[model samples]
Target: MSSQPVPCKNLHEWLSFLEGLHTSEIDLGLDRVLTVFRDMNIGKIAGCVILVAGTNGKGTTIAAMEALLQSAGKSTGCYLSPHIHFFNERVRIDGRNMSDETWVEAFERVESHRGQVSLTYFEFTTLAALFIIARQMPDFALLEVGLGGRLDAVNIVEPDVSVITSVGLDHQDWLGEDRESIGFEKAGIMRPGGVCVYGEVNPTKSILQQASAQNVDLRVFGRDFGVLDADSEPATETMTDSPVFLAQNSAQQPIPDAPVPVSYQMADGDFVRTVLSEQSIPVSNRLCAIQALALTGVRLDKIDIDHCLSLISVPGRFEVDKNNPKYIYDVAHNVHAAEYLSRLLQATRQRRRGKIVCLFSALKDKDSKGIVSLLDKTVDSWAGWPMQVDRALSLAQLTAVLGDNATNAECLPTLGEAVVRAENIACDRNDTIMVLGSFYAVAEVQSFLTNRANRSRGVDEKGIEV
Candidate 1:
């Protein structure tokens, strides 16, 4: 790094330089990152730290938790990964993305002491976010792991409360080939005597085993806690008008909404009469969020769940671009995420008359077949292009994974080109275009949609999502 580049002066320069620090994009291990943290003298953050890890629902859970905490008057610093639009999206202080100046300063801090330590792109950037958050001194620090928990750089922080959204096969190459193995790695974030919440519909043996081994106070969904799904009217055909997690089952019921007064029931015969404005999120997500908040000693009554949920909308995660010929956006790269996407697609527009076309693409390392098959039953057609990035799967590779379904997939030159084709098809068939697959796919599609919409008005695509 010293031989190749001069000092980085701006956010882009810092990011570019950091990307080249390591030979690989993802090098799993905390020794190098921890060493750098110590060198910078970054002790534990002033606020409470909550570590979130899992295959799916990490973002939603984090958003819910952050909102609940903030609504209860806690200033929060949140760090997430794989930003859809801007790098600043990764780190948020008090529900706002930190400015470019803050990032540049943090990057410099990390760079100064990382002397001989080679950190991966995620590692360096994660450290930078932590530095900024610690300096800002928020009341709460929510860290989302970039990869598996045991080795991810974020795991360096021993969270006071740990949340596992769900265990599934996604990063099979690094995490594991099955749910059991993956659960073990994710369970690494929990410490003895800490309050750990798992949102899995069916808790895996490995997760239970690990929690037991460490003597962590583990709460499992459906066992120790449960979400009393809000009994609300069916979501309108126009998804933009409603906030619903859309049922994942084939029946597409509206999660069998709870009574007029939605309440979350704890295992000990206690219940909190709750209000959630964002009723569209998964019940499991909300349940886990409340449990986490309670575990962290935040008063449930102080949280304006509805107001908080309304304020937090994650982009590239079922992001709605248009209404009529609906354009749904989600970054469902792996099988676990794909399952959630498939259910979301079915549950939302189940009664709508429009056809459903899922626009997709993925990197070479993902489980292309598993991801594709999960939504095949609901998607009317598929359209995508090999990503422009180096790790993108080739058209041939994608076709091979898609198999007989490949006949229905349209291979285009670029995602923007695919966007145009999808719009044309939607116009002809009255279809809803779902932009999904990798984060790159969602970002490109989001960019295309924002650009198209702004052509007449000429404005930068600035989205306020935490």
Candidate 2:
């Protein structure tokens, strides 16, 4: 719709322009992007940039990084993709969404540099994020690769420490069909002499091979460093009363029962075992973030890190919005994530007295069948809806993949309708409801629950008191 180097007055305008800039939604490679990156001349950012790549757990890892870094009083700029609600949430500095003016300026800078190369939406956004981060010069610029790492726009920047959160079968058309192929693509973020951390319990062979060939100091999760000990504390009165999301009150000490104390060893042979009371970030994800931070030469005191853990919050990852019915929302689309969600749901089911109600939707490109298959046994009843997106796997297609269990699955007209139907069928307020499949599904479910919660509080949809 527009030529390179065109000016945009606002963030919305820039986004609209970017959508039609390139012929296709995804064009993976670096030659054209590299040329434009050099034109932007963000060669030496004043701060350190940590590039994180993987199939799942990438968001969780970066979330912990941001919270921990900010807790230590370091200015941080983080770039994430496919936001749930707001676009500004994708780019944050000091844990706050960047203003519209800041994003517009960054987009203009990137537009000014592209000579004749046609950059995809993700590529264009990547450059803009880097430009903004460089201008601010935060203590650390955390970049989450939009897709498979090697040719992804963020890979153009050299990261002091690269982390592969976990690899799985996703984006098979571009990343290959198996874990080996996908791992190689993600490992492309690693640089020679740079440190790389593998957070997957069993990393792919290709990942290990590529990092070793690059002479990277590869830290393996099980061998190099593993979670030694971890135990969960009991819930508190505050949490018991609210039961949805408990914000960290600076004046209060963490409830002894809320802490999920975990022990792990780092590359320095130093053991780091601390309690993460906040369910916002899981124990495994916390370990990944801690290792990445440690690699950055940031000496963290056990007490300090533990204290900051209370402040960590990652939206849409097992986000509990209602305690009575145990309504939880998570963006777990792939098989690896499904396994994690299954375990989480299983544990949650054991603690409660009712069956689980799963409201789900997924993109056609994802392993929708595998994901549904993993959660099928754990879920008692399924309520699914059609996603109004380009790559949405139709209700019929999903049912076919779900196999014999298709008999039990009910498809609704829209995601919103599915949410209502799920809540109605969840037995009562004591039963559990899980909203999963994709970020789109979780986002919509969250809105539904939020609106309902407001109504219950006697507030109208317009935020007016009844």
Candidate 3:
């Protein structure tokens, strides 16, 4: 531990300093973080705290909840993990990224009171986010767990409500190798007598056991609250074809599309019709967010829900490049997400006569083989691009899994080259190019496209002309 005052004067310098504080990138546990939390005396940070955990849908569910709460005239503070572009994206105050000065101030406070308690990169940043949120004192504080809920740094805060979006087989090394074990880890956020809104149709035995042990009010999807199939119908609205990601202004915000209405049966057996932003969101996640917010007494009228959902956009999930409808990007690295993406591709293929080409890469720890195999039937071809990160899967590993399907797969040295190859393959064929795999892969492609768009607009990354 460094006894000298932190040598950082800015957010960038402090981020670098925090990265070296611990040898490992992830050290999941609450004791070390809790000590700092108490030392900092950040008690009662918000009027209501919601802890959300899951394998795939955590970010989407939390984003939905934040949007809904804010629509109801409640202040919201959100903390998300594994940001796409910048560290500032990890912490949002009132639907906007906090300034670099805000981050520097929060880090200084955490460093001063840390008192030799070494924290990992995630722990340090999480503390800084909580400190900032505490100072602002938002009405609703939404915390997304970085990993398994049981020992994650965010678990140090007691939550009024917990949300388990879906339990899947990601991060098996720490959480466990099976769905049952993974469900138990996710169930850690539940408190006795508190409400937990589960999003999936079927609940794993471990989750049920945990909730029963804690005597928690677990409202499950397809049971206590779910989509009212009789009244629910697909919306006929279509999004305007425009570039969703722009490098200029550093705000890749997607424009608001027409609201799609969804009907759901609430816990009281009463049906409510809610309008969500777009059809890209899975109905299950939207239902879970509404149910969780309902437990907190956030009753929103139809118009309010529409307004909020229209303004909400979770990037890197079913993000289509409007300039070329053929180019799509999604951060689907695991089996569950891949299956959903595959179904989407199959549906799109049915509507259009064209081939589906997937540009893919994944982390060494992810189930890349499973994802590729799951989408193999729906995707006519594959373009493998190794992410630039150390944990990214090597070209050989990606090819080894392609195995018998190697004839249909093409490997490239970099993401940019791989994308060029993909575009060439899909050129003039009316085929779709879907970018899938880990977050890093999607972020790289998004950056490439955004830069290309900025250049075409005669503006640099800062929106200044050359």
Candidate closest to the true structure, highest TM-score: 3
| lDDT computed for candidate 3 | 0.80
lDDT of each: 0.75, 0.76, 0.80
Query: What TM-score, to 2 decimals, does candidate 1 have?
Result: 0.87
lDDT tens string, model 2, 1-466? Answer: 2235565677788899999999999999999888888877887653788999988888888988888887777889899998998788888888889888888888877777786789899998888888878888899988899999998988988898999888878889999989999999998999998898887667789988998898998876655543332232322111211111122211121323445444444445565545455454555567778878876767655337766765665788888774443788889888878777776776677678687988888898887777777788888888888777778778787666655554367888777778778778885767888888888888877767678878899998677999
- Residue-by-residue lDDT tens digits, candidate 1, 319-402: 776433488788878876776676777765564667787788888888788778778888777887787789889988766766
Off by over 4 Å in 2: 1-8, 229-269, 272-280, 322-325, 448-466
lDDT score of residue 280 within candidate 1:
48
By TM-score, the better pick of 1 and 2 is 1
- Model 1 misses residue 176 by how many Å? 1.7
Winner on TM-score (1 vs 3): 3
lDDT head-to-head 1 vs 3, winner: 3
List the candidate numbers ranked by TM-score, top first: 3, 1, 2
Give one digit per residue, the lDDT tens place, for model 3 in 206-253: 999989988999977766655433334443222222111111110112
lDDT of 2 at 129: 83
